[model samples]
Target: MGFVPSQDADKIADTVEPLAERLSEVLGVDIQAQVLVDYTGLVEG
Candidate 1:
């Protein structure tokens, strides 16, 4: 798996890297996941 930053800053990049690392180790495989910042309304558009 690989890691990438969508934009420039600590907030976005800082979020997913550790999660991917830990997930990779815990799953005992090359694990990859995307972190989506869901600021949109959950109930409706």
Candidate 2:
């Protein structure tokens, strides 16, 4: 997932990672999440 303003990336990851872990536990599957901040905005561009 992408966050506007970039700085929120860490905060977003902090929140998401735990949820991903919980989902993995409940589903008995490996759920992974990597929150990357695109400073260059190349993805959007």
Candidate 3:
């Protein structure tokens, strides 16, 4: 997930983590919520 540069990192985590948890349950696998630093970071990931 990508957030605006000014958005708080914790806010991003709050929004994404829950979804990740739900997905992990449904998929029966670990799902990490990775917040991208930038487009380059996403590409590298």
Candidate 4:
């Protein structure tokens, strides 16, 4: 999957990164994910 950058820098790596890692480990796949900033940014992407 692919996406364009959002408006705000609300990545929240501390939370999102670990969750993605755990999910990937449990599911046995390289899960690519992203933390969106807001509704508009999410919709546009």
Q: Pick the candidate with the highest lDDT.
A: 3
> In lDDT terms, how accurate is model 1?
0.56
**Candidate 2 per-residue lDDT over residues 1-45, each given as its tens digit:** 333445676787888888889989999999876665475663654
Q: What stretches of model 1 exceed 4 Å from their correct place?
A: 1-10, 33-45
What would the per-residue lDDT of candidate 4 be over residues 1-45, giving only the tens digit for each residue?
A: 123344434445444667778889999999766655556666776
Compute the lDDT of residue 22 as modeled in candidate 4: 86
| Colliding pairs, model 1 | none
Tens-place lDDT per residue, model 3, 1-45, is 344334776788788889999999999998888777776776777
How well does model 3 score by local distance difference test?
Answer: 0.75
Please give the CA lDDT of all the candidate structures. Answer: 0.56, 0.69, 0.75, 0.61
lDDT of 1 by residue, 1-45 (tens): 333445653565567668878988898988665434342422222
lDDT order of candidates, top first: 3, 2, 4, 1
What are the runs in model 4 whose C-alpha is more than 4 Å off? 1-11
lDDT (Cα, 0-100) at 19 in candidate 1 = 87
lDDT, model 2: 0.69
Worst 10 residues of 1 by lDDT: 36-45
- Please give the lDDT score at residue 38 for candidate 4: 59
Worst 10 residues of 2 by lDDT: 1-10
